[model samples]
Target chain A: MTRRIRVLIAKVGMDGHDRGAKVIARALRDAGMEVIYSGLFQSPESTARMAVQEDVDLVGVSILSGAHMTLLPPIRQELDRLGGGEILLVAGGTIPPDDAAALKAQGVAEVFTPGHSLEAIVRWIEAQVAAARGQAAW
Target chain B: MQPDREPRPGTAAARPADPGAEVEAARRAYEEALARYREALAQSPEREGLFTTLSGLPVEPLYTPSQPDPDYLAKLGFPGEYPFTRGIHATMYRGRLWTIRQFAGFGTASETNARFKYLLEQGQTGLSVAFDMPTLLGYDSDHPRSLGEVGREGVAIDSLEDMETLFEGIPLDQVSTSMTINGPAAILWAMYLVTAEKQGVSLARLRGTIQNDILKEYMAQKEWIFPPEPSVKLVVDTIEFGSQHVPQWNPISISGYHIREAGSTAVQELAFTLANGFHYVEACLQRGLAIDQFAPRLSFFFNSHLDFFEEIAKFRAARRIWARAMRERYGAQDPRSWRLRFHTQTAGCSLTAQQPEVNLIRTAYQALAAVLGGTQSLHTNALDEVYCLPTEHAATLAVRTQQVLAYEIGVVNSADPLGGSYLVEALTDQLEAEAEKYFRQIEALGGVIAGIESGFFQKEIAEAAYRYQREVEAGRRIVVGVNAFRQEEDRPPEIFRIRPEVEADQIARLRRLRARRDQGAVTGALAQLRQAARGGANLMPYLMEAARCYATVGEIADTLREVYGEYQERAVI
Candidate 1:
């Protein structure tokens, strides 16, 4: 069988809102992805380091406390700095479309906000992993 | 400022009517009614949908006067009496309407101060302060950890000056303020007390509550600066100190707001919150404090969710449970200690980002339930909350929703009007029983702290959250604007924006204060605070001294951080 799609979910900064992060993490695990949740209060540097160390194929960060404008770039930069540039990064939270668009432009593969289903997120992650893995045969 | 104990209304409603005689007569009548109902159901079979509450608890098609309560009067009791099931006050809202406390804060202290003034002018009965994540986490605006987070979410108060500005012209004695800060609650609370002192207001005259319930922070909010043992000790210190000096102030508000927001069912919210509150009571008792003294000031905060009747039932159950436990178990003599007064905030998780206008209706109904459920104070969520903090327009509408509910809706005309309703009574009984089951389970886990240590609460909340997500995904839960009624164009609502300059302005202000304040005084006060923290002495007085000397939140927190190491939480999912 193909290697299980590995993903890491992170909640960075002083934001303690983890309901979304935990839900998404479990959804991925149920979707047959090997998932690592970065728990609460992860720094950008530490989150990126975890993704690289875990050798995950995708990293999803939830920034509900509205610090995406300040925290997202560093998380992206640190992932690239730590030789995890290949790891596709996605974000989620109560982020508005304007900031979501800016974050997407800054290399976030996708942005999921409230009202987005866990299935939609799982599907997005699955498609990305399959495409990145050359659409490997089942 | 204490509520008068006279004039109870719901209490005089009716006695339970002898259960033995009534149950037999009602049973025969109920049987006939049930048979007829089944015959009608067989012909037209009701609607093709699940008959369940928002929390997924099964609801019967009809409720009848069955066996009812074995000892109903003792179990529910009268309003403002033991087991205050109907309501805490005799007249409830008829005596005094629930405080319309809008939880508002964003941008710089000055900007938030303006919003506060505007809200007070708009007939908001109380003030609630929402601090930014940095302030909530005990970091200064200039701290590296506070970058991008300074005043972005809520007001940032790095020093006494920020707090002084935040409450500039507002007299501390006149207005009741509730601060939503847990991890650094002691520091923020001290800042508030010092602000009152600067205004020359006696601490005894202070009427406010600090969300200093740290156990809930560890279990649900995940915003702890210190480990559980010391964090709770700090909370007890505040309670003991508050009871002695700030007698009118509630030092801690045992909260299930975040617990419900984190996806637990209403029953879990009630049980876990009461368990946490009981733990605090036990902790204070261990510290040699009288239960009557501190428990009277002990308050609660609950979330009013989408299920109107269910949320109402939860609140009713909460009151009944707390009253019984406080009087029977904890031996609190003061009726004030037994009364469970809570401030309810409508569920933010229930609001949708899609078709944001729909959230107003949802919030209005939730507010109505809170009023019917006998909330002492309420904070209605704004329509734009799903995206960000409420804009001025959104915030005004939120307050108006409460105003409408209070003034126009006529919900306050009767206290616990649903008290005798068969369905509500059944739900209250069912919820109270369910909460008792959870209480036993939590006790088996060695109480709240041990439950947190074992990740029991985290796991339970996570499972519920994931299940809720799946329910929405499967279309089992038809959330308007999300699953069922999606308008093709789901435009974003007007969002309140904290200026990009807020962080910079706050930092500059902090630097300016640091340059002018007595650096030696700051050092001396923080040292004394550390010594008190090292010993068993209450840290509140020393903290007040530090706040008096203008010691920054970060400095005082870091000083204690030296002695009580920071807590690192592991991922449970």
Candidate 2:
């Protein structure tokens, strides 16, 4: 049997505001992806470790704290250190467009800011999966 | 029909000279329509209370002599009187403004302590401690499960050493501290108390609060480490201990903030929070504590959401309902017990990452609503919260938001500025009625614990949350940068980042602590904690001993997990 696209939906750092994060997690689960939620305040190392251990296709870091500048890079770095460069890295939160570009440069595949609907996020993930499978890239 | 005519400014634009005349004409027309409706209703048997408002309160199309009784004084009592729907204090903010509490913590105790001092210097009147997740869960910085978690959520605290460092130069007796911890509240409180004692401050002199609300934990936060029964038992122990020892400290802050943030409506927040408060009151009563003893120290924490009018009405209804229940139902004589004081945090859920700067505007509006609604203390979330832990600069702005409201706005000059406004009062009355209905339903459900067990509260909250989400998704509701007024070209400027080395450093610290601490004492403490967990002994004292001996949170959690097992929630919504 083909393995499901395991996704780790984790809230990084001290941000306890999880309503959006929960909504996204549920949407992903409903989409039939196996999601392992690393509950709030996960460090980048733990996030990377969990992504590797769970053998997830993607690691999605959700942060609402302004600390994303200081927070997201470490996860990207850790993923590289763990030699999981092929595993897609994604982030969502209050990140600005410019910061999103910077994050993409740091190994993040995409940045989902506020106003990006669940459909958009799910579609993006689907596209990423297809691209990885040598289909048309989004 | 007629050619358009533009009137001169001096002469009424188009015969607009009759100001009072126009008013009279409009009034007469409305009265005639009202009389016609009344006559029609009189002839129709089914049209009994057509003039009544939707909230079931009697109203009239017009307030005339024939409109029936208008006993204003009877319904709208003076501020600070029975059924305090208007305001709690006589002077309210006129005499003394609400405390500008900055909720902040990051990295290590020393780092947070510096931030605390900085905030205090910048005019923060009170300290609201936001502990790291491991600390919040009662795990030490060095625990295995605590890896990559230290100082990330808030400040990492291990044993009395961390607590002492957290409040090193800060005088506990002088500055009131509100620690936002729940599951491990008793242990944390013990640590706080022991720290205060070491600071030469007597327990009786210490004044502050612990967000030791575990019922809400099960309903919303999911930070709970124990089952409902053991958690409530621990909370009761804190209440008992506080009532006897820390006379000035509030043992539990019945929190509706998290519930509202969790997607509950205003009525659900009001009803469920009051239900949880009553549960605590009942537990204290069961422990043989006087209704007034623990009740007076009981405080509330609420969320000031974006719906300005609804948020204000919720606050007004909350005070009235709490006051009435404490006086009439609980049979409390103390005025202190009758007062329902609360701390309000501007809705973090309301802030959007999409026009991140717009969050400052959202926060300002929510902060204004909280002040108008009469909060005792307030924490304004930073605009950058949706990104990472708020930068010091961002947190300063958050505090400044409160200061601007307190001083610059002159809004604190009077009490309940919206008290007599028709819309505000009507909304407050409506909220009160709706909340009362839920209270009755909860009563039928055998109160809070039963409601919680049956998943009734969670179902209600989840449904409301989902419904609200649907509204936002469907554009029925407007979130400035989210569902509407969206700018595709905009992007955030900067985001906070955490270094991987921080986690590596934290792991190293844990390893060193383990190597340095007495292996025998650590083993002995874990054994005693496990034994205490198995038995009916109050876990606070035992946890305190464990904390003192450097037993990490994971060790304590492991011990309790052995006894209680992990909680696997059954989805209800």
Candidate 3:
């Protein structure tokens, strides 16, 4: 028996371009992952609380309004503070290379850009979450 | 055209008298030719692989005249005639070219001002302002929640002082400026009017558009401040005020640009935008304003996507639908009210980050569609826009894209160049029918606001987006550099980064303005705005007073927030 992979697709802050977030949520759900979507205008603290409360395996934060540097790191720290320290943090949207590197340094496990496929994201999340649980090798 | 749908008298009876025998002869000839066409399709070499637009509208292998072909005059009259399928204006692009308005903003007010001057120097006709996220969401630069977001995406505008700097050297009456602001559009619009007053321009001479279509904000763009009722009231306030004072300005640019960018189908974009426009018109009528007084200035904004013919069909269908509805359904007696004037922008969602330069080709084609489909104004997206704000070179190229089309392309020689083509007319009719289907569904759901509350528009858009991605992933849809042409590695393009100091600089400026402005006047004006929000009075006058006194946009918005609550929607994905 295998545990279902649970994930939270979060849109933090005031970036209202949620197309990417919504699309990825459905893709992950179709791939058999239990997904929790934090709608819009969510603070970093509330996102972290929702991630912990939902007991998700990963938190995929999306920001396209070019505020990733000011918004993503706090979500990472808040998730760590709320006892979800090991929860995988992933992000995507108009993030530049330097900011992507900085976000990685601050604790984002992986970063995707506009060109990445939904399949690639799903595969990466499944591999990382599956590896963390030490589940059977598919 | 039907007499009831005609905007002017005596135009319906002008069609040539029916040629009874010739019409029958043509019908028989068409039926015989159609059988041969079917035979050719069955024996085709490639079998014509599933040709369809991104809207899921099936495209036929070939189109020819139907039995008893439609009368030309009835279907598409003169460009300026009723049911304006050909175009809204008769002298389309001959007297004046479509406004080359590129949507540009980033960094501080001074930086954006420099860019605006540079664009004007490069022959740009109109100024389209794109506010940063904080300004778009109605937050002051110094707000704690505005942390790293000030001036990141667009220009940071916090007060009348910032608006003054934004248009310092530029005269408002000289060039039309369009602001891409919703949510707090009333607050920002008040700022512009006050800036015009400071610039010493008459309010009656002001011309431009405010993207104040908040119904779409709740349904698609989702940058709403107050809930539906209050936000719509504010929009009506602007329309009412503009009709009286700023007679030349377009108060509400009912937009489908954001809706299409939000991953809706082309037909859904057409349907949803017009439905939202209807909602605004009904709101104004409910407020006891004449349809003609405010409806003429109500313009539209649409998206030009990579689907060449599909996008054109959407535009044509939009014009015809609007004209018919205004004249027949709403009984708008004014000819200007019957015309649907829209500005088109090449779709940002169509631009891929990979092989970023190829986005130029996509944009050029999309701009061509907009021109061929009769856009009154256009903003071509730059290649670098997918990753960051466009660099100067890229933005210039975007402006140049329009210049070449205007000068060299000869596309503007006549109105609706593809007007009479069998395929184009059929597709236009198809799109109109499809849009009517969606309109009926929306009406059944009680209206645009009700549909938003029930999450209907959100769910429909999500499904379409998912379907698109699934098709792309399954190799059914080929996105040039992303899917078909396999590039081993993308050479990272040169990126333009907004300076990190922008956030701090804007915050300090906002704090200083708050510190120096007449505190008592600010409080008094905002109090008045709040009172008007609580009562039945129009809020625009109060907002203008507040803006004239250097009241921050957030202060006025927050005061209204105290009166009318914020909007919150459930996640639909």
Instruction: List A-chain TM-scores for all predictions.
Output: 0.94, 0.92, 0.95
Ranking by lDDT: 3, 1, 2
Cα shift from native, residue B430, model 2 (Å): 1.4
How does the DockQ of candidate 1 come out? 0.78
Q: Model 3, B218: alpha-carbon shift in Å?
A: 0.9
lDDT of 2 by residue, B1-573 (tens): 222223322223423357777455445544554465456434433322233434656543222223322223223334565566766766567546799887888777777888899999999999989887777776666555555566776777666666888899999988999999997787778778878878989999998899999999778876777778778887998888788888898899999999988888988888889989988888879878899888889999999998999999999989988987898789999978988999999988788767788899999999999999989999999988866778778888898888888766556755677877778878887887788789889999988878777878877876687678768877899888787887874554455554445555655666677788887887898798788878867676787677767666567667777887655445442
Candidate 1 lDDT over B1-573, as tens digits, reads: 222222233222332367675556544544554465455434532333444544777654333234544244445544565678878865566557899999989988899999999999999989999999888989899988899999988999998898999999999999999999898888888989989989999999999999998988888988889999999999998998898999999999999999999999998899999999999999999999988878999999999999889999999999988987898788889989999999999999999888888899999999989998999999999898988888888989999999888766556655577777768877888888888889999989888888998899999998998888899899898899899978876455777788898888889899999999999999999988988889868998899899999999999999989999999876799
DockQ ranking of the models? 1, 3, 2
Model 2, B37: alpha-carbon shift in Å? 42
Give per-residue CA lDDT, model 1, range A36-70, as digits (tens): 98888889999999999999999999998989988
Ranking by TM-score: 3, 1, 2
Q: Could you tell me every candidate's TM-score relative to the true structure?
A: 0.90, 0.78, 0.91
Q: Ten residues in a row with the worst lDDT in model 2 chain A?
A: A129-138
Best by lDDT: 3
For A1-138, candidate 2 gives per-residue lDDT tens digits of 556777988887655556667777777887888887786667789899888888788988887554576678888888888877767888887776677888888878898876678878888897787677554232
